[model samples]
Target: MREGKRLGRVIWAPVGAAVLSGLVIGAAARLLMRGIALAVGGLTGMSLAGTVGILVVFVVLALPAAVTATARPVIMHAGRWVTAALTGLMAARTGVSDAKIIVLADDGQLTPITVLIVAFAAIVVLHGRLAQYLTRRLRTLPESPAEVLPTPDARPV
Candidate 1:
């Protein structure tokens, strides 16, 4: 029973992280889509924004699954690729969103792909360690404490 419970805890950690990350990343992607829609200024822009935002959400959700599955040494190298992909997507999404603001400031147009490329380069070059931080943190969390109960003598009759 204890082992089963332990297995459940192990399973719950990754599942819970994935759900929470989904909600958070989903909101951020929505905001980015809104920014893209505003920047592109048409129905076509809304379509593109929706596509990119959905892709981002899907990519972010995949991170937790990747981390959970790659926890063992059998395919350890795959973990690095997963981390890199997640980080790159995060940076690209952020860059596109930031570019929207920059375009507004300059009163000019900018392509999302251009900003995505620049952000990917910048993040890989400057913040290489940011990848997997959240997933790693979740993976290392301590298990819950054991339960305690009162003895029969201590219980009310």
Candidate 2:
């Protein structure tokens, strides 16, 4: 029982981090989307603004995922999973009637949960690929020495 408790605590670190990161990132994404929408709408027109804003948000959000994927793929994967879960929870909390919106007539509509799932999947794939490419590129580059060898006179006592 004690061992099980210890294992549970160890497992919870990544799980907690994933959930916290997801919640924070989701809120940031929403705010970014909203701000972009308002700015674009005011500058251009409503219809185009909505489309452009969403595109911008997706692109912008993907960048961090790509970076995190490179630095820590596990964290990125966990974050994506948590994001999807949170989206579902939020949708349920809001009630079914208000959870979905029509994006296109013939193409079909999507709920917030669906959008988040799609976005998270896209981010994971894109970031994973980008990270791989970057790693390859880095490997091909010549290594630089960390520092000049310490001179005999300069050596510490």
Candidate 3:
């Protein structure tokens, strides 16, 4: 319902929040995936062939997912920033200024157990959304001719 109407600089609040949240989720997801792998593989004990297979599956599942999950909000925020910057409105500052320091201090910490719980939840949610988004995005991409399997090498399409 609130998609339309700039409502002034308040727009940045949501946009900035999403991007920051997304980056946090991405880092968390990668760490979680790595931890899962380490637990299942024990850091050094899985057989080479099995480890390779697991790794291939992990890459197929995780990398694109993490990227898309983290990228959507970033792209949206960039669009907002670009438009606002051009319109002589507020601009995003990527500096270690006092305000940034305050924001970081405020947002970067919590009770340790609460931090772990929230971080785990964020990563899992982002992973699910990322997988869905990436699957849809991949489906929308054009298939390359090379990806088409030849008909038994006996017939050409």
Candidate 4:
């Protein structure tokens, strides 16, 4: 791959890691939600079917984490984009249903935009090392004066 692409990889590493973290958090949230659902379902006397439903929820909840681990960069980028859109969409409304209108009005303090900015910042910060890894520098070979290859221009016509 070209150095340029590798450069992006280096830049995106931290973002990818953060994305993975986000996926983990999301999975945790889903797990909790499913657990709650199962408990409620059981209390309602929903039976083994209710517990089976929770198991299904667990499977669904685990998918994002698995996907993010495999493709964290893409996930991070998508999340950044989606969060930005959601923030913008939320910003345009007046007398919103939310009790926290200021959160939407603000650029990112409470918005998903915060995640985007952070991921972008992370990518820019660590891009160099990533680029180096992707496009590793040519190794220097020890040589005597005679070991050097003659330049084309230095050769006799």
lDDT of 2 at 131: 34
Candidate closer to the true structure by TM-score (higher is better), 3 or 4: 3
lDDT of 2: 0.42
Runs of candidate 2 exceeding 4 Å displacement: 42-157
User: Candidate 1, residue 34: CA error in Å?
Assistant: 1.1
- lDDT of each candidate versus the true structure: 0.51, 0.42, 0.39, 0.38
**In candidate 1, what are the lDDT values of residues 1-157, reduced to their tens digit?**
8688667656665555545555554545555545554655633244566656654654454454435443665443455455456655765776666665555643364666345345445434222122234445555665553225555678787
Whichever of 2 and 3 has more TM-score, that candidate is 2
Pick the winner on lDDT between candidates 2 and 4: 2
lDDT digits (tens) for residues 1-157 of candidate 2: 8577556544443334333344444445454334433432323233566555543433343333333433466866654444344444443443333323322212322344356445544543443344334433443333335334656788789
Tell me the lDDT of model 2 at 96. 39
Residue 135 of model 3 has an lDDT of 38
Better of 1 and 2 by lDDT: 1
- Count of backbone collisions within predicted model 2: 0
Worst window of 10 by summed lDDT in candidate 1: 123-132
Which pairs of residues have clashing backbones in candidate 3?
A: none
Q: What's the distance in Å from true for residue 147, model 2?
A: 45
lDDT, candidate 4, residue 88? 30
After best superposition, candidate 3 residue 42: deviation in angstroms? 17
| Model 1 lDDT, full chain set | 0.51
TM-score of each: 0.48, 0.29, 0.27, 0.24
